[model samples]
Target: MRPTRAKITDAISAIERCFLRNQDGTNSVKDSTDSLSITEMTELLESLRGSIQRAVSVEQTRKPEFDIFLLTFQRWLLTDIARDQALLCDLLLPILNEALPPSASITPQTAPFVEKTLQFVRDTILRCSVAKDLIGKHMIGRLVATAVCVHASTMLKRQALDILNSLLAKSKENKALLTSHTCLTDLDNLVHLLKNAGDVELQTQLVELLFRICPKPKQERLQFIDTLHLPKIFADIRGDYFHQDCRAFLNQLNAGNDGVLKTPKSFRLSHAECVLGDTTSSLTLNPPDGADSLWLDFNTSSLSILVMIAGGDILSIELAFSKVQRWQVESSAGAFLPMTPIRI
Candidate 1:
């Protein structure tokens, strides 16, 4: 049913009142002493969400009044409210994902707003199933592009990569979208980020993302690695969490079936016949101490590869390919030895 203008006005008024102050100068929705209990607060938030949804639905048809209402609501989310970040994320995720798609009228004036909303979406998607489900094909490329925007904050960029990691875990279509030429600019930014990432976590995630984007088709995968320019990118990065994997990625590109293992004494060459499916290649290497044998498993999926070492205790270090890397093994020296490939 079409809502009358009076009904729309009432909805707008209800939303506006969420940020309004009482005669005592206390906030109506956020302050407890103003006679708003937790249940009342939740009910009020639900009412405001409905009003915002209605305004968003109306704005789709070029309704100016609802557009104004949306602008006002965005302002409230940005300023008027403080503790309801979850609500803000829930409110903005769908609007950004469904309403303001890549074709939306995002001028310089609105770009900050769009980016901020994406940051919220990035933070929410990890814990909120609804936000995770909102990620579709239309949003995937944009999110990748957003992650590498030169002006984007490190927090936003990392969150964007994190969100991509989650989506890449869910389906191959997301991985395909990332590998396509449409993300050329994104990949460029990714290379830039890889070289310049002061944030260790950010750089680690970048490598994992690159692994995820490795195209499964043999010809395309070779072309994609060439497009990555891994050697040039790796030259600047050293002594980082992804050093060995970066070497392995480069070796895989340069020599299809052989890998290089570096020791203080000499460099040893190892071979593994590159496989034909999603699981691209696996290599096992022996460390100098002969304490543990390292196993490296590479996959084309977004979650990327897992590096495991076997000795007295089985140790697993999952690359940021998924979530957090697991490190459960320690050395007799009383230090936590990171579970990395010996050299492959």
Candidate 2:
């Protein structure tokens, strides 16, 4: 017979009642189940997993038992029950993926549950070494990246990004694994979200993660950098907190490619100067106080410049350059600031 909602609720309630809050605010299983062996605990989770799988498949949206099930797991995690090997990865990871499938629609009611489930996963991984080990063993890097790059809910995306960062920080191999799994579409989605991201911390973390994965050798980077429109997005979003990272990313990409520079026709040189030493190089454009946009091309090397309304009324532009003999800047808006323009 199919599992009824009442039956699932009763099962979850029974599981929940097995744990009680201690005087120290920590949870512990009641004496009756406290002595349960690892095999018995695993069996209990397996039973709960079967109920959750069946119930969630039957009712994709608004299942109270599902909420209780996650809470029961969360409470269970707070106790010694979670320290056992393979229990978290074996039981929880499947339920996590089921709760937030990549293609599932995230209703407002469902969004909170999704966030809650992801939080549980993150917390489990962070607090339990055994669970962290499962991240690599199970190859769930792609699953976490999908949440970051494909999911619609910002809350869920943020949660997943945190989980991704934690895993990447712990394992060097995961950096390569995740980068290999990420495609052009994933990069495009990440850039799109960063462009519209209102949270400063989110933008910072996302940019840092992008930088970590994107700065490959010329052959590897040229495949996606141009296709994802990263340069255009970088140029467009300057003066935000991540401006330096954006500029540095471009410089890194430019350093790798040896092709001739491609300059747009609308660029007009106002001022360009090349200093020989290793301090830093900057391109300053003074566009008639209220000018809208500016374009410049470094024809000497493989660097192209595209600037938008950075800082809204500030016309000064600064960029770090290396090994370039010439810098050419052009303004379509107004006359240049009279600095000598250099050409390679």
Candidate 3:
């Protein structure tokens, strides 16, 4: 049922009165949270989410103030109301949609907005099964892009990398999304990030993500190592790479025919290969068919070769080619490692 204008107005008024109070000339997060019931909070969040999304869709000349509302709303969602999983799922994605500006670049001034986004992913989005695959994981490309955005503050980049690491620790669904075709299409961008990341910790996180999603196929894995061209970086990080968990990760990758770090074979151009990226959306600033960047992606279990064209007057395009090719990927029958999904 459509909400009557009066009903919407009353809900908005109630939300303001409930959440925007200054007692003793100070605003208390606790008081604000306690003022509304879960149901009321859900309703208010939906209403707020709708308004923000409409503003974004319409590309209003004036940017909406959803960012301010989101920071406050997210705090209560993460802490005071953490146990309400349903409300978190219902409200978190829309909050994210509100936080991200359609055409705005991720930069230093965008730190707080990105940080709140990380907090949402850590506390709710990553662990919330309902949001993990279909809704939450889609943030991967955007966050990865932020980690490499030249204009982003070092602080934002580090936090963005940390959020990527956190996403991997949540579940297989999270890990799978990291390797899925939509994400694999962003391989070129990830390549840029891996090469340019200056911070030691940030570099480590990027390396881990890269290796974690290294294609299951031997040839593609070799292609990744060759393309990345950072041969000695990982080897020189002796003390850090030897950590128990890192060692375990390394061991698993090297255990069988699936060894991702194995020496590269000749770079043979093949139709059936995988590259993880989001070129279709990322290359919108340029012109249509501007760059015929060729690569392959695993759209789930299926394989596709794509040439990305950056849109000029129109939006970007992802072109898939039909050609027959085959590469044998060895299936690992090894026992799975003990699971410890951590988030911070």
Candidate 4:
């Protein structure tokens, strides 16, 4: 027999009472002295879950009223009284995901409610260890990613990114999930944000987050390379700025001079240079300091010829020719230039 409205309402009331009792410490679920029986709690949770599922399904196409019901359910779940938030989260996640497509036609006022419901779900997952544990095995990541892409706000996008980051930290399997269609699309959007965002602090956090989530081996390298297209999004300095240390590091790398410059052992650049040329002077190279400036009189149609240096030596060479795409140099040393901007 179909569940009556009274029956559903009664079930919801029972769950709400259980939540309230737990919060007031009168009916504590777990107590060293006198704990509530697990069987009783389990039965109540199952009943609540069933009733909520039915209610949401019954109200799915109802628009405004349905939205109100969902919001009520969401608010109740989020409030601390519902100590069994994990159980609610488990039941709600899939329903929310499935409900989204049909609700796409919902009115603007209802849309925010739907989105907020989803956000509540996401936030709950983040806050609850049990919910977080279940996320990798379910569609939570994909669901959150989808919501983020649909919503244009930076705040929502950041929430989505935080969920992904948490998932990645939870397990390797979650990291693999990130590359999936729904997650990847969201990531692409996030990458776009990181590339375009002008805020220094946000960019730094995003870059670091991207670096942390990036897979090891070739995938990590490839992702970093792709990020080069938008280089301005990351912060180059952390503490007191100094260029001398950077110059020294470059000089050490160049002469094959110390352990720091050893191939594959220390950071080394393949080429470095600072070249300047105009339309008339083909590509010409300026010699080292104190030496006659070497002029390459070769005629090239291009207006500019970049100075080239090899073997990753000389602070100046490292500063000038380092890849603008991958590396971000931040130093206050007097020897080297203030900051070298790399594309990657």
Per-residue alpha-carbon lDDT of candidate 1 for residues 1-344, written as tens digits (9 for 90 to 100) = 55566676676565555554557665443433333333444444454444444433423433344354444444344332234545534544445553332433344444545554565555443444443334645467667666666656667677678777777775677776666677677788777776555443465677777766665566665567577766534333333545455545343333432212111111112211122223535323333244332333332221122233444343433343333223233333445434322222
Q: Where does the lowest 10-residue lDDT sum fall in candidate 1?
A: 259-268
Q: Which one wins by TM-score: 3 or 4?
A: 3
lDDT of 4 by residue, 192-229 (tens): 65534322223334554555555456655565436544
lDDT (Cα, tens digit) per residue for candidate 2, span 1-344: 55556776786687677766666654454445554456766766666676665544524556677678777766666665457656767776666666565533455555656666677667655676564446654534444554554434656677767776677664656666656645445555666665444333355456666655654466555554566666634433333455444544444434432233331112334444444334476434444445544444333232334444546422434333354444444444445443233333
lDDT of 2: 0.54
* Best lDDT among the predictions, by candidate number: 2
> Which candidate tops TM-score?
2
Instruction: Write down the TM-score for model 2.
Output: 0.57
The deviation in Å at residue 131 for candidate 2 is 5.0
Candidate 3 Cα misplacement greater than 4 A, ranges: 1-39, 50-68, 75-91, 101-103, 107-111, 123-135, 215-344
List ranges where model 2 is wrong by over 4 Å: 1-4, 24-36, 54-60, 131-133, 136-151, 181-185, 195-201, 214-229, 232-344
Q: Which stretches of candidate 4 lie over 4 Å from their true place?
A: 20-92, 96-108, 111-124, 127-133, 140-147, 150-152, 180-184, 193-209, 216-219, 227-344
TM-score of each: 0.41, 0.57, 0.49, 0.45
Error of 2 at 160 (Å): 1.9
User: Tens-digit lDDT track for model 3 on 202-260?
Assistant: 54466677656555466666665665553422332333443334333333322332111
